[model samples]
Target chain A: SAVISQKPSRDICQRGTSLTIQCQVDSQVTMMFWYRQQPGQSLTLIATANQGSEATYESGFVIDKFPISRPNLTFSTLTVSNLSPEDSSIYLCSVGRRGLQETQYFGPGTRLLVL
Target chain B: SQQGEEDPQALSIQEGENATMNCSYKTSINNLQWYRQNSGRGLVHLILIRSNEREKHSGRLRVTLDTSKKSSSLLITASRAADTASYFCATEWKSSGDKLTFGTGTRLAVRP
Candidate 1:
């Protein structure tokens, strides 16, 4: 099992500003994923952060809006740019441990409220 | 698009009663997992059932998978008030790189 931690557990930011959320894993992982959950909604996959490569974003999400950086196997960052009230959601980081049959462990989450 | 969708959007039951939630997916998957979230906190993985497996049990939790129907069910027996929360089923499709697609989730309320 891998232990995951996220920074800025909760933050309230002004509209048009940017906030970067960090994810740290206790062990090296092959892949880390970013997700978003709006109020009263399910989790949406934002992107897959791969070490030493550009992140692969899902449909309806882009790097320009949610830029992701994975400098190493155990660390990654996701930046929500040009925030708006609609962007007020909980952002979560998850990691998949190797040989675990693809069970992903998640961070506590970063609650962002764009005012 | 979301790969999984859970049924009975909300369920309220008395403590010690059983709670059952169902999830249906649109595509084939390598594995399906169940997770629990307490309010606004992160999700805690409860169990994972591979495509080849039909049923699995963990403590008071029982998960069953029907690959042909592309559906799964999670049953929690003798529930407590603390078990009240949102439960989600995630599918790890073969196409997507190990990333999970979560369902809307079922809100279960276990009243004492």
Candidate 2:
């Protein structure tokens, strides 16, 4: 099992500003994933961050909007740019084991409210 | 869409009663997983059942998958207030690489 933590557990930002959410894992992981959960909705995969390479984003999401940085094996950051009321959601980070079917360990998540 | 759909969007039941939720996907999957989220926080993975497997159980939770129908069911027995949370079913499809597409989710409220 891996222990995960995120910074700025909850934040309220201006509509046009940007907020960077950091995710840290206790152990070095090969892959880390970012997710968004809007109010009264299920989790949506935003992107997958891997060290030494660019992140792979899902459909309806792009790097320009949600830029990701994976500086090392245990750390990654996701920036929500040009925030808006519709971007008010819980951003979560998770670390998965080697196999695709392995269970993923998730961080508490950063609650972002764009005003 | 590629995402799956879960039935009983909201469920309210007594603490001792059982709660059952169903999920239906559109494509063939290599595996299906169940996760629980408290309030709006991060998700906690509960169980994973492979395509070849029919059923899996952990603690008071039981999951059954039917590939013929592309659907799965989660059953929680003797529930408690702590069990009140949103349950989601995620699938790893054979075509999609490495990411799990989540279902609509079911909000279960266990009354004490």
Candidate 3:
């Protein structure tokens, strides 16, 4: 199992501003992912933060809105640009081994509340 | 949407009893997993059952998968107040690059 942590466990931001959430893992990992969980809703995958390459985003999410950077195996960041009330959600970071059926470990998550 | 759906969106039970949550997905999957979340925080993975596997167990948690029905279930035996949390089932779709599509969670409240 991998231990992951995210910065800014909870934050309140003004609308039109941006906030970047950081995820750090104790051990080097092959896979890093970003997710969003809205109030009273399920988790949604925002993008796969691939190391040394562009992140792969899911449908309904775009790079301009959610820019991601994975400079190395143990760290990644997800920035929610131009925040809005609807963007107020808990952003989670997860890590998994590539090409395996193993469990993915998650960070404690960063809860963002946009005003 | 590719998201899975969980039934009985909310559940309430007394401590020492059992609680069951069901998840149904739309597409074929390589594996199905169950996760637990407390107070809207990051999720803790409970268990994972592959497509070929029928049932899996981890301590007090039991997970059953039925590919024929495209659904899976999680059973927490002898539930405790500490087990009160939201449970979600995520699926790794075949050929989908291991990206998990999460289901609408089941919020369980165990009264002590």
DockQ top scorer: 3
lDDT of 3 by residue, B20-92 (tens): 9999999989999999999998899999899999999999899999999999999999999999999999999
Judge candidate 2 at residue B31 and give its lDDT.
94
Give the Cα-based TM-score of candidate 2 against the true structure: 0.97
Model 1, C-alpha of A108: deviation from truth (Å): 0.3
Candidate 2: stretches off by over 4 Å: none
Q: For model 1, how does the per-residue alpha-carbon lDDT over B1-112 read when each residue is reduced to its tens digit? A: 6568898999999999999999999898889999999997999999999999999999999999999999999999999999999999999887765878898899999999
lDDT of 3 by residue, A7-114 (tens): 989999999999999999999999999999999999999999999999999889999999999999999999999999999999999999987978989999999999
Docking quality (DockQ) of candidate 2: 0.74
- Our tally of clashes for model 1 stands at 0
Q: Put down candidate 2 lDDT per residue, B2-95, tens digits, no spaces.
A: 8999999999999999999999999999899999999898788999999999999999999999999999999999999999999999998988
Would you give the TM-score of chain B in model 1? 0.97
Q: Could you estimate the TM-score for every candidate?
A: 0.97, 0.97, 0.98
* Superposed model 1: Cα runs more than 4 Å off: A98-100
Predicted complexes: DockQ each: 0.72, 0.74, 0.87
